[model samples]
Target: MIISRISRFISNFDNLLALFAGACAVLAVLFVLFLPLPYSEDQLYPKEIDESSPLYPYERGGTPFERADIHVQYPENSPFAGYVTAYLTPFSLALSRLTPHAGTTIVAHPGGILDEILYNTRGLDTVVETTILFIAFAIGSYLFRKGS
Candidate 1:
């Protein structure tokens, strides 16, 4: 809805869509890799389940075994972990079942140094260049519009 205001400020819906798409693509990659969610702190620096920790079920504060559920504060010990473990456990069973049926063939091919660098970097340089180009295109498209 806010972007609708830009229609009057600029011109051409196609340019707006291009700008929106470019911005969204940049944000998607950044959030997936670099941006940390609020639970990231808890996930990274999980407190030990000791007397000093809030997760400790002590007689002084928290009841002992009164809560039969695994708390989300300890993500590693949560039901989600159990679910993921159960899901992946089938893969190992399937692999074991299929191992004897398949022929064993292992091949290792070394890639070039340039290819390795591009693979490891994931073309961040390309992303940066594309982002600059997108910004420039949006600005030019708006400024060079027929009316304004």
Candidate 2:
């Protein structure tokens, strides 16, 4: 029966090792999902710009209304900047709507070092998943080797 086969597999040392490996894979996934990234908003968006920057038109001999009208364009640094903006904008909007009083500004910035960091962090979700898969494979390999 299937139960007998499973029981035999579980009783084997190699199978136990494989099971432990599989458990590690599962744990890694859970950790990544629940893990708080060791980064903060301030750290991610460093004090690169100041009130004195030309981008802040108020500092450049402009009226408050004129400054408000001045729109700083996204610098042409990377091709994917647009895509990242497109994706995060709506997500930020939804977050803002969900928490009306949260007071989170969700503006998209074009490519810079910060942009790259954001992209990498956003993309790291896949890396976390892949790492789990690799761990599982490694454990499985060890178990198979022991069995052999």
Candidate 3:
């Protein structure tokens, strides 16, 4: 009877883990569709391009500045959100490279944070990767339950 109770508890714990993965997958998808990651960018050609400005090089007709399209930021009030975005960063970066103009690029340049979260989410690549991982984890969980 003790062995049976222990096995049952383990099974329930496994189920909970699967549920958590599923929830995370759904959250990632929803974030891609609705959650707005923040970003800040200046116009390429401002009326007055200062010597210290990034566009200064381009203003002189020198080699074009090489940089990502966008730089994203997390809310200062919430560190968890930042971690999630960081986790998605790898997949988003790879996708950005595969499609240069896909509009999900992130740069490390320093920029002021805006009080808006109405921009684009990380990227669909993050959703795809998370979903795939969730599916694989669910399948593995099922197999483990079946085997035991």
Which prediction has the highest TM-score against the true structure? 2
Worst 10 residues of 2 by lDDT: 63-72
Backbone clashes in model 3, listed as residue pairs? none
lDDT order, best first, reads: 2, 3, 1
Top lDDT model: 2
Better of 1 and 3 by lDDT: 3
Overall local distance difference test of candidate 2: 0.48
The stretch of ten residues in a row with the least summed lDDT in candidate 3 is 110-119
- Candidate 2 clash total? 0
Can you list the residue pairs that collide in candidate 2? none
Model 3 per-residue lDDT tens digits across residues 1-148? 9999767866887677877888999999998998686654554222333455333321222211232222334434432222222232455445435654433233221111111112123345566778899999999999999967
Residue-level lDDT tens digits of model 2 in 45-147 = 2333334432321122222212111112333443343333223344554654565433224333232233434454345766787889999999999999996
Q: Model 1, which residues run further than 4 Å from truth?
A: 1-122, 146-148
- TM for every model, in the order presented, reads 0.20, 0.24, 0.22
Would you list the C-alpha lDDT of every candidate in the order shown? 0.41, 0.48, 0.43
lDDT of predicted model 1: 0.41
The CA lDDT at 28 in model 3 is: 92
Q: Roughly what TM-score does model 2 have, to 2 decimal places?
A: 0.24
